[model samples]
Target chain A: MAEYPDRLKDTLADFNFVTTRSERAELLIDIAGRFEPVPARIATRPYAEEYRVPACESDAYVWSERQPDGTLKFHFAVENPQGLSAQAMAVILDETLSGAPLEQVATVSPDIVLRIFGSEISMGKGQGLMEMVRTVQRHARSTLAEQAS
Target chain B: MPDRSSETLDLAQRGYAHPDVLVSTQWVADHLNDPDVRIIESNEDPLLYASGHLPGAVEVDWAHDLNNPLRRDYLDQREFEQLMSRLGATPQTTLVFYGDKNNWWATYAFWVFQLFGHDRARIMDGGRNKWHAEGRPLTREVPQYKPTRYKALPRDDRHIRAFRDQVYQHVQVNLPLVDVRSPEEYRGERLHMPDYPNEGALRGGHIPGAVNVPWSRAVNPDGSFKSASELRRIYESEQKLSPDDEIITYCRIGERSSHTWFVLKYLLGYDRVRNYDGSWTEWGNLVNVPIER
Candidate 1:
């Protein structure tokens, strides 16, 4: 089996110790405060429909650029101002998966949403966040496929 | 032209049966420091309140605060009292609820509060989105209030709530049941939508004899509810439902239906409307329950 990205593993370790919902919410909210949307050079307003994440009510969009070392850097835009969870998720995916080896990034499971957000999340929210992780994995897989071809 | 100065005055002209239950954003702003009022933000997103919320507002999470930790039921009377106490709210405190998704979860919280007979509650007319659009102040600073000694009545599921057996009986008698989900969900097509995941139902479709009235029809684009006459056209004229009818509303998990329940019982002055909180998730999974596509 491919190994998980080291940064993702470290992030999960940090969440593992969250004993209360308020503690976890504070941490995720702080992470969301650091979220930066995709720069204009990559994409802009009225983002292309092709980049939109499916089933995401938050109206989130994603893009990837190849780094100098063949790794991928992910960028995201969450259109809904109240979509704080999506913002936090965008930040986590970009910080941990960007510049990591494609294989390792692809191995990151969607189940990590449960670990990070906890089981109390609504069903629709849980599904939407998982879809975000899947979208990032799809980008990494497609990049690896292009390299192989 | 409508008066733009105060939402409360504007709401009065809309002619809802119980317009006082809905307060405008401006009204809430003015009441921010009113010691008798407690502003509560409830949303489907757990992180929304933590990110930034209305100044002096407290969060009441649907999962962590309302639900019974062990069972699928809601918190009991003791639990309700504890929750109110934690919020520093006595029976006299007026709770004004608002949240994202056009107050979908806010109404759900309001419904749960009703189960405990908290009648002093009001829903912010336009919810969190409208507040944000108006550039209302949002702060990350969490407020701490001295806990109050709150007294709560035993939960009254008999009035505004319905269980599966009652729903089955309602169907048997051919009473009105409004399915407040999307058209696709009402038609059992949500399960097969390309690239979309199932919404946790073993089967698809709605309860037998239900009419599809998608809940959003009650609200305008700005997230404020449509006027009483407009809503009457949808529910009474188009759907042919009567204010005298004993209606039961349900959605995937009863969240959306609570929105409709609020509309019928309060806005249109329907005398008997109950929300089936178990909704499709429970009914669709039950072995012998009847579901119609």
Candidate 2:
């Protein structure tokens, strides 16, 4: 079994203590408040369709830039202003998986969406968030494959 | 291209049969502190209410607050009374519902409330998008209200809701059924999109003898409902549906169908309209159910 990223494990642990719905929502809203979109240095308006996350109603776009240490940094843009959940997911993916080892990042389970967002998340929303996680994993896996080639 | 804002007609001018069932954003803003009115925000995204919502608005999560925790059915009469008490509302209190996705979940919550005979409800037209676009105030402050002692009647599913058996019967009779899903979903094209999950259905396509009318067609680009004439053109003139037709609407799990149900029942004044809450998730997965691609 592949090990999960340390930061992601720690983040999930923090979410574990959130016993109440409001408390969990507050924590996620605080994270969503800190969301920063992909900067112009990486990409700009009219983003390439290839970067768009499938099944995401929020119209989210994902980008990964490789750092000097060979780690990938994930960035996201949620086009819908009301997509607070997508924003929080983006922030969490970037903060926890950006500098993590590609192998560990690639193995991150999308089920962590249920863990972090709670089980009550809607089917459409759960799928979209999971797809966001998958998009990030796809980037990591692609980078690894490219290096191996 | 016509300016969307210019194209928007006032609620009164839209010619809906029951214009009172819809309140404008301005009306909601004006009624923010009305003791008789309660603003409820329901959304698919759980974080939206806490992030920011209409001032003094309460959150009623559809899955958590409305649904029965143990079963697929909704909460019982006791549970409905408890929820109303928690919301600090009474039978006389008017609930004005609005939320994300152009009030898809809002209309859904409204539909559930109706099952309990809570008819003192109205949908905030254009929902959160129009409110935010118009720079209306939103707050993160969750309000505290004294819990009211409320009583609710037994849920009346016979009138507004449709079961799978009822849907099958409706199909057998060749009555009008509107499938308010995307064209791809109606055509069974989205069942196997690469890397995309199936939307909780084993089979694709729509119910037999159902017409395809994506729910979004009832609303404008700004999220507000289109004029009655425009809607009439779509449903009556285009689809050949009559105002007196008994209709049933369904989508993936009944949320989107509720939106269409609202339009046909209230906007077009259809005589009898029922929302099949089981929708495609139940029908598509059912054994030996008729499915048309």
Candidate 3:
């Protein structure tokens, strides 16, 4: 059993309405369109190794912060803006999990991506998506660990 | 990288069976304003064209244009005609294709065009990488053109395409089969290309009696095909394959094999070369299929 964020649940609900490959592709492309670079002030910093998503091939960077309200905030950036699948995954995860509680962020099982993309996504990209989730979760876990310390 | 673009290979002098099938980046740059020429950037990464492409070029999503909207095969004649008309291409229009990964997808698009009997289509040698490596200009602005009235030739799957049945018969007869994938993939060591993620095929290795001649062997590190004589030596002399032998090339998803198919049919003037589009993705998943480690 897993607990998901409210927004994530709604997003999944919205995606569930997509029953065809075109619909899923349209959803992904729409979400990918929303991914853009973070502000230069933050982008210029030495992107910490812990913030980087390993083996993404597009060089994605992520960071998470624990707000005073005990919710998580995520910042993400990637080198290849035209990487639709990878960028879409980043945007989708950030949208679903940012401002979400640590527990909700941790609840994003790998299968959610499979449910949304189905078999339409290629195996390489599927691996890339899992790697992305792990990277974001790594950041979220660090944020929790830092707050606890 | 050569600083002077003139040092680039003189493609017209290559003496290929279809020499006009290739055009240099300089030629593409020179023809930017030509009304008769249409530049179409076809890439494996569907979104790559959005980053930047050659000036006045339009992007074609191969899966969107080439695939049958409702079925598992490529678009029918009517759909292809509609697509051509929508893209402002007429029967007489000359289409030049270029993209990332050398010209893997470019050649694939060319193969699809050939399948539909569009003989005027051409490949931009070295593709986007070569064009960009030489510091040619890339524009973010996608051009808009008036759509034209176009009619496509009836789709012909024969002569160029090989189906599972044909491949099985070829294997039974022990006809030449070129496994145009990475060495690891050919040897059953990897399910897919070393860099490509595995797609969960139940079996590993290649079709029995297939010879390993990695597609990259036909191409240079910079993503350009080698000279015609060199290519002939590699395929005919080195591999001990004859130009007249009936040949079939296959890869995981058929894109890389299409490239080898291009080199054999057009570059080396091999008359009986065909691309098994289903390739390993279909062969590896089937039950009771003969696979050699």
lDDT for model 2, on a 0 to 1 scale?
0.91
Q: State the DockQ of every prediction.
A: 0.56, 0.66, 0.19
In model 2, which regions exceed 4 Å deviation? B1-7, B192-199
True contacts recovered per prediction: 0.78, 0.89, 0.15
lDDT of 3 by residue, B51-138 (tens): 6788999887666777665665788898888878777888888999998767988898889889889988889988988897789898
For each candidate in the order shown, give its overall lDDT on alpha carbons: 0.90, 0.91, 0.79
Task: Specify the poorest-scoring 10-residue window by lDDT in model 1 chain B.
Answer: B191-200
Q: Rank the candidates by lDDT, best first.
A: 2, 1, 3
Instruction: Give one digit per residue, the lDDT tens place, for model 2 in B43-80.
Output: 99888888888989999999889888787789899999
Error of 2 at B193 (Å): 10
Q: What is the interface RMSD of each candidate, in Å?
A: 3.2, 2.9, 4.9
* Chain A vs. native, model 3, TM-score: 0.86
TM-score of 1: 0.94
Residue-wise C-alpha lDDT for candidate 1, range B1-293, written one tens digit per residue: 64332333388888889999999999999999898999999999988898789999999998889888788889999999999998999999999999988999999999999999999999999899999999999998999989988989999999899999999999999999999988998999885222323337778888999999999888877789888888888999999999999999999878999999999999889979999999988887799888889
TM-score, chain B only, every model? 0.94, 0.95, 0.93
Decreasing DockQ order of the candidates: 2, 1, 3
Candidate 1 vs candidate 2: which has greater DockQ?
Answer: 2
- The deviation in Å at residue B39 for candidate 2 is 0.9
TM-score of each: 0.94, 0.96, 0.76
